[model samples]
Target: MTTTIIPNLQNFYNQSQQKQDNHFCDCTLQWRRGQLLVKPSGQVKQPYLPSLHNQPLLVECLKHSPVNLVSIDPKLGESSLRFWADACEQAHKPIFLRIPPGNKLPKQSSQSLRWLQRLIDWMIALVLLLIISPVMLILVMLIQSDSPESLFSCEWHVGQRGKLFRAIKFCTTKKYKLTPLGSWMCKYGVDNLPQLFNVLRGEMGLLGSRCWTLEDAVQLSLKEQRQLNNLPGITASWEVETQPKLLHLDSSTL
Candidate 1:
């Protein structure tokens, strides 16, 4: 079976691999014909699943072999994004469709939850800094003695949404001047300590999406826009989930 990738769903039928579904049909007729196409807007189109089957059969197929995400543009107004979201839930699929009120965004669970999380992060980072202060101080001295550079440095990173922030870190050398201490700091993640201030200042969430760069975000695929759908965390989901999935998919596809 082959899947067609057309920016315009209305043209799916006309560019058929074979004439079996060459006739144009509206979404209503296509759904009635037990064919499912992951499209947001289309007046006339071919249903990807337009086999001689009923709704129940189509539902079963969807449940078994479903596409995980389909982002629909809310501006299209061809179909209710909510309706498709519900249908996807019933079929155990997930649609990243845009909802109404374009300005609406994903929010923290609650004000209390946000404050509590922040308090917890503050306490944890503070306590850790207190305990490790002596060691960090010694490391700073050693780093200064070993290298002719500052013990700390700041790098710019894209925070939540597209805001830029200076992420301070304890470092063994200045920019572009690597030292032996830098290697050890990298191995142990000790250089990441100053970002505790970022977590405290609410520039980033403790657990959210991955930190990105302004250039990196600009270069992302339209399909990858969902990565920015949520607030970026100091440690992010992309570092875990998307990275591994892409690796496996690339190897298998090759």
Candidate 2:
């Protein structure tokens, strides 16, 4: 089967092949039509599953195959972005997608306007914190009363221009564990209230693309990484548009 390999990843394939390390780049890429492309580094141990016979081969391949990760070709269309994103989340694998050349970039606001917006974000976050202090205190008390553990969670996220920052949230999940109160906090995003401090500290904004975790961000193509040129935000279009579909997919998988 003919698999078009992107030139940039050719070296990675070569290195993986030389090292014979399945741990490094062992994956099957779904190329044009129903063909499967194994990373040249090493052969994928799983038998080939043809997509022409069974659609959703990407997800199925990952679900059943022994391969540790998978990559999707960008030509699969915009909908594939949503599809693969959900698929990768389910597989808990690193995702890689090539953004087509000359893709229109998000317009960067002028420096002065950016400063003004930052000023506004700081002000709003401060006011929100003040207004919600009592509610936040109550949530904290409820959380402590329910779980009796650390009150916050700090995760590293990639911010504007690839700066790493610790994003703070209520410790709603404790490494495969969650309490009833923690689940409620997560469901309503009350767990995220601590991020107001991130905004106040100029590490985040009121609205923009949700900052991708460092693990995910580094895997993105340079063009896709352009989305990070702007500050990370509390919420973004992905929530309203992309996330509900993912939730549905997640539910269907269960």
Candidate closest to the true structure, highest lDDT: 2
Q: Each prediction's TM-score against the native?
A: 0.47, 0.53
Off by over 4 Å in 1: 1-109, 172-175, 237-254
For 126-236, candidate 2 gives per-residue lDDT tens digits of: 999999999999988987877676888786565665455678887754444666676566556677788899998887899877677655665677678778666778875
Question: Root-mean-square deviation of each candidate, in angstroms?
Answer: 16.8, 12.4
The sequence of per-residue lDDT tens digits that candidate 1 reaches over residues 116-146 is 8778877877777788888878877887888
Residue 186's lDDT in candidate 2: 53
RMSD (CA, angstroms), candidate 2:
12.4
Q: What TM-score should be assigned to candidate 2? A: 0.53
Quick one: best TM-score, which candidate? 2
Candidate 2 collision pairs: none
Candidate 2, 10: how far from true, in Å? Answer: 32
Residue 75 miss distance in model 2 (angstroms): 22
